[model samples]
Target: VSSIIVPITNVMNDQYCYQTSKKIRQVFDYKRRNGQYIGSNPPFGYVKDAKDRHHLVIDPDAAEIVRLIFSLLLKGTSKRGISFYLNEHGIPSPSVYKLEKGMTVSNKPDGNTLWSGRMIHTILTNPMYTGDLVQGRFRVKSYKVHQIETVPEEEWVRVADTHEAIIDKATFEKVQELLLRDTRTSPQGRTVHLFSGFLKCADCGRAVTRCSGKNNVYYACATYKSRSRNACTMHSISHARLEAAVLYAIRQQVHLAVSYSEVIAQINSAPIKKNQSFRLDDTIHAKERELAKVTRYKQSLYQDWKDGEITQQEYRDMKATYDRQINEVSDVLARLTAERAELANGVDKEHPALVAFKKYQNIDALSRELLIELVDHIKVYENGNISVKFKFADQLRRIAEYIDVNTAESPAWAV
Candidate 1:
């Protein structure tokens, strides 16, 4: 009798465990869908709301630091340089700041409050700073197994506008773009020198870095620096010479853009008329129509299956195919529509990037904004042959093609 009672009791306990697990999972899923901040602590730029633990509000001091980091980045300061500035000013890193506020962190950095490039980079890249709530990045394997595993990025739960933003979306995007470029810092002045990441090895197509020279600074092939010259050429360009070359190239383009009617004509014509501009609109419309047709077919699939026209498995398979095609067409249609809208709106006078060269017409100096916007890249050959590829080169060529076909009034540019 005792053995029978014990077995029954074990069965009852297992049933209770199963039900409890299901209920807990349901609660977690509901919270995730509602865009709550589930983490124990808010991100660096924010503090969790006292009454509503799931909501976040800007931490004024941390928010200011975030803005300064972005501002310095736009001004061409590299991540290391920014980190140095923060450390030198005795500003606390996020972990340190939390600790000072009497909050306990489980995995704080081993080091002190000294800032590092990695810390700055993490904040710069985080979408949370843009007011997007991204959760479920890691999860327990199951109820029985408590091991944590990283969820793939595609599977992470994301909801936008969950809180006030510390950084504007445009600035965040621009900072991301800048981070991808060749920006590096000098240990000398805790500053990022001009043309830090701009130069590249013309031969191997690798990035060039600055290194010690006899009595001056010189740019050398990064590959050579790592290995030896046997791997790549010096591909050397001095700081003074490289700066001058870049400046001269920019000044030349600015002169042409401002003084040359041809440049103005190209800038105007490039957006107004693309040979494929009409094609983009036509393709989008076609895809949108396809999506509608697929949707209509999907609606009929259930009825067809109900009337015994197709097997259950076949009905499901065909329905899935139609749904997938519909999604694909919708995505393509959206992208093409955005492209068409952007080109159409480029003619607006208030658009800052539209014919940006015009703003620098009376230019006396070059800014990071101008450098990034106008120059795609500069290639330095071993023989000191510097090539500056203007961002608008392809557009200028297309404009020339347009003018050639439409009328003979267009002036041809001489190399």
Candidate 2:
């Protein structure tokens, strides 16, 4: 009788614990789906809102540190270099800072706990700094086991715009892109080269490797320099020459952008300007009507041949012509439809490219930050020439077309 009573009580306690754990998990899942901050502490750059623990607000000092880390990365500084700089500057690591702030926390580190490269990497990779709530990254193994395990990324809960952002989305995205590049720092230098991971051979399509000469540095096709010269030619351009060319290109683009902006401003400010959408609508309607006429003509061919109104050969010939016309009109209609939709979705006045160019109007020198923000990549030809595919190319093209269509004179890009 004693054994039976003891076993029954133990089973009852286990069942009760399972029920409580299941209920708790359900509540937490609900909160996570609703973009609530479920962690013991908010991420380093943010503090839990005093009025609402689920909401995160930027902690000024820590947020500044986070911004600095991103800025340094964009400027081609390695994570290790950034860590060393922070430590040399006597800035506290996140753990030590939180502890110093007297925040309720666990596993507090000592004052001497220095920032690590891994710490900088973590902060740079975190999407939460862009104002998104990213939770459920880790989970207990089970209701009863209580062992922690990393949840797969796909299973992580992500909700956007839950709080104010420490980093803008574009800059954050650019940092992520740069992280994926071959950003190897120079052996003697603390930062990466301005064109690191961006130059590619136009002929062989291989990356260009940097080479040091007696008096200057040059970049040549990786295949030509190291692998096999037979596979590619030496698309070499000296560092100074490349730098000068790139700077000149950037300056030209910046000037063009400024001119385009003024044109856009004048167009927008004009009292008697044409309605862009209305023009697009009219074009689309004309194309639609032409398509309908051709389609009707195509459908009439079959009836004409069957009713003996025309010979089979003539009917076939007419049908083929109509089909060609129909296809041509369809292609035009599709393009016009897309253009109309774009006009319907109004253009962004402060487009990211426009804003970036506006911010860096006088480009006397090229910095890593400038290159990363403006240019996508440089294609190095064998003849010591380069073609730079700038970022925001599509947006720039659209703006150019807008200017050409609206303005009475030729647009900047047209020239």
Candidate 3:
């Protein structure tokens, strides 16, 4: 009886291992097959074939249009603006071009050819534009793994000057710099005012959007503008007035920063006291541990659902709760990390905002970049205090707090 039982158990264990290995292999195979094909041969104007390892020739006209589109994108046109421009001129998108070329392409509104942010970003970032053909930047570790790992930059196989330059190297670099900078306003469907989407009408709880009046732009509560009778008052603020106030506040902050530079310099020159260093290190470690725990909890909740241990509703509710907690914790962790970094580096005497403000300070006129970098919002509070939040207010506050704690004298510029 013991011998029979032992053999049965051994068979069951072997079968279980085989089944698990088979499932793992299937997942691995799927991942290996799922990635975009990157080959030594140049596809030029076409995507790789679905099954065969050959370039499917694209329409010549369409290819020309692609080059044109890339050129415009590299010239720093926003994706939505590009889309509008293309559609307005009756320029055939890639999908339309394919269709016209006798290819049976899907006729969806946002088909394979829609000019989207991701598409524009990809084109701009693609080293291919710089005459460097890079392939296989991403790959699956195994056939069973669903996760794709990015290959490091140094490992990328790059063939230099593989194609004719649509955008020059200088212009491409400038576009990349712009992309890296946080200068993008809301999309084209939204208003163009730098403060349009940023500002919220305190009373109406809607975006303070721009309206044209007597050839001047004024911000009005969107909700009140639409539903005048039912909603709150318009709470309109003149664009000139709002812009002036925001700029003034930013200027004041910059002035304060400049004035406080002596204190900042002194602080940087001062020796890092053991207690202060320990405090910063401790705070960072604690925040890191908290972040890890939250992440683990979030992962475990997902795993529970994947394992069929939790019902859909339960999973959603738990996930939402965990997500909110995780977000709050993440924000805290970020703040702590920033604080630690500042402590470690001896915070720059001149903040980026201060430097930017100084450059534009002499101009006497506000540009879009200046507005974006300096101002966060110009909120028309219900209490009648037009609160102007500067973009670097949090950093300023942190600096003030650090100064107060570390030094005997109060920083004269602390606001």
Candidate 4:
């Protein structure tokens, strides 16, 4: 009797424990999906709102540090460099800062705490800084096991626009792009070169490696210079000449962007041409009528066959013809309707390319920030020539096309 009672009590205690854990997880998941802040502490840049513990509000001092981290990364500073900069400036690491704020944290320091490259990397990569609530990054393996495991990114709960953002979306996206690239830093340098990961060899399609000559810094094809010479030729170009050419190209683009902006403004101000939309509407109406007539003809074929006015084979052939015509007319109507909607929408003056280029209109020198913002990559030819593929290339082309179509004649500059 005693043995049976003890076993029954043990089983009941385990069942209660499992049920409690399951209920807790369900509650947390519900909060996370609803964009509530479930974490004990907000991320480094923000603090829990006084009125609502589930909401986050920016903490000015910490938010400034967060912005500095992003700004330094954009300026080509390496993660290690940023960490060193913060430590040298006597700024506290996230854990240290939290301790100073009298907040309880699990990872308390045993001795002097210092910032690290990994910490900087984490801060830079966190999308929470961009005003989104992302939770469930890690979860317990099971109620019984109690082992933590990383959750796949797709499985993580994300809710956008839950709080004020420390970093804007575009800048955050740009940082993510840069992180994926192989932007190596120069030896004994704290920051990457202006074209660290941007230069590519036009011949072999390999990265262009930077070299130091007796007096000048130059870049050569990585395949030719480091790997077998038989693989590719030296597409070497001096840094000064390349920089000058790139600066000139950027200025040309800025000039073009200003011109495009003015043309777009003029186009926007002028009343939209009703004739274009009217023509599209008329074509759509005609197609709709054609579809209706074909559908009616298809419906009449069955009656004609029943009345013996047409043979079964003749009715089948006629029905197939009408079906084809109906499909064709329906497709035409869809296309015409889309065109009419586009005509009504008109050209956007604040197109990203126009706005981005206009921001750097007075550019005189090239910086890593500017290059990352405007240029996608620079292809170096064996003939000492470089081709820069700028960002928003497609948008620029669309803007030019829009101007050409709307204006009486193509502007001489545009041509």
Q: Which ten residues in a row have the lowest lDDT in candidate 1?
A: 406-415
TM-score each candidate. Answer: 0.65, 0.76, 0.48, 0.78
| Predicted candidate 3 versus true structure: per-residue lDDT over 252-297, tens digit per residue | 7667777666677787788863114444556768877887887788
Candidate achieving the largest TM-score: 4
Tens-digit lDDT string for candidate 1 (224-297): 88877798888887877887878787777766555445543555666444323544556787888888899999
Error of 4 at 352 (Å): 2.5
Against the unseen true structure, what C-alpha lDDT does each candidate score?
0.76, 0.85, 0.62, 0.87
C-alpha RMSD (angstroms) for model 1:
8.9
Sorting all predicted structures by lDDT, with the top scorer first, yields 4, 2, 1, 3
User: Could you give candidate 4's per-residue lDDT for residues 233-319 as a string of tens digits?
Assistant: 999999999999999999999889888888878888777632243334567788888888889889988999999999999998898
Q: List, in order, the clash count of every candidate structure.
A: 1, 0, 6, 0
Residue 296 in candidate 2 has what lDDT?
84
Best-fitting candidate, scored by lDDT: 4
Greater-lDDT candidate between 1 and 3? 1
> 24-89, model 2: which lDDT tens digit per residue?
989999999999998987888899899999899999999999999999898789888899889999
Off by over 4 Å in 3: 1-191, 270-341, 350-358, 382-385, 409-415
Worst 10 residues of 4 by lDDT: 273-282
